[model samples]
Target: GKVPILLPPLPEQKKIAQILSTWDQAITATERLLENSQQRKKGLMQLLLTGKKRLPGFEGEWETRKLKELCAIKTGKKDVNEGNPDGKYPFFTCASEPTGSDEYSYDCEALLIAGNGIIGKTHYFKGKFEAYQRTYILSDFSNAVSVSYLHQFILYWLMRDIDREKQHGAMPYIKLGLLQRFNVFVPSIEEQQRIAMVLSYADQEIDGLEFKLNLLKQEKKALMQQLLTGKRRVNVETEAA
Candidate 1:
């Protein structure tokens, strides 16, 4: 038995191919922009968060304080199995993204750090949310510290510190004591806010680039389906004239 194939006229086929090729180029350019933006943010975080490069009009020695001095640290009561996909609030575990949950145990501006598995991974959330038993929540920030700045600081430093703690033959994990004793370089709240704002702008740029990339890819996919299946036909003769 011979299979039937739906093929368009040569002129129409060429027009469709040209349209898809343009989409491909746009998607590739957006992907490279997204990558470059991410790397730029990473570099900015290292410099501004560490006080190695100061923003204009700010000059002073930063204070070094232990984590316990800046905020209260505690763990969540819920287990990983308790998450609900259709629930109302965020359920944070040791993973990268939060799942949905019906119940929330804490309500505040807080930083959540994974205590085990993927040790040192951190998330900052404000408002009501549930958390896994092993996730460390840092809240009740001191007046002198900016929680936003602290979150950025931990994002850059804690993971690097955790990497050094990984022993030969042992699974890496974070202990309460390690967090309690962890040191942070604290600038005045004003300087902290300034640095955090610059980094936040960089994040927004990266996000915009990523959204554009997704839209381009999706448009190309839908166009391919329509053209290849003959659901949409190109008017090659009109375009040529």
Candidate 2:
């Protein structure tokens, strides 16, 4: 049996629905904007990583290298109990949980790749943080061929290869050896920075927009609950017949 909708009188129902419809329209518009931005970001990544799009003041061919050639995979400490209450360090795990400790493990900016169950997930850690054993830290960026460029490159490569490597009956895992053999497209440092910056900006904007949309949705939901329940009513004067 279909649940009956406790709609108000015809005119009031129309008004309530109209208000909700306006909110829906705003949500739809915001969602479309987010999608467009994401699509553009993807396009930028394709062009920038492939060297087809060159940012102003940058000129050079990109170099190619394997993951091991550019970074040393450092595993995090395994002591979960080592978390300190007074410690002031950020903790990271394969699941992106910040629930470990406040101690510095690797003191530098490098890309962190999930090495075990949630393999190939990449995070750029720029501050002091404690990382879980299941996570692998990338260090030695300064001496590498192109650290920043390779950082983004590995992300793109992982995005492409992760699903293909996930086999049924076997847990998804990214072996360090496999990462070592993974090919990377390295652009000049300047170009690499440019591309990373552009993509990062897009991501930030998307996050901000999503946050705003969520807030707006919550507000709309609250309004609907109150208005639909007859707890709040809009004033509508009727003329004498």
Best by lDDT: 1
Tens digit of lDDT per residue, candidate 2, span 90-154? 66666644554656766888787777645677777787788777777888764545555666677
Clashing pairs in 1: none
Model 2 pairs in collision = none
Off by over 4 Å in 2: 1-8, 79-88, 96-104, 116-118, 144-148, 167-171, 237-241
Give the C-alpha lDDT of model 2.
Answer: 0.74
Q: Pick the candidate with the highest TM-score.
A: 1
lDDT score of residue 16 within candidate 1: 87
Write down the lDDT of every candidate, Cα atoms only: 0.89, 0.74
TM value for model 1: 0.87
Please write out the lDDT profile of model 1 over residues 22-124, one tens digit for every residue. Answer: 9999999999999999999899998997888999999999999999999999999999999997889999899878888999999999999999877888989
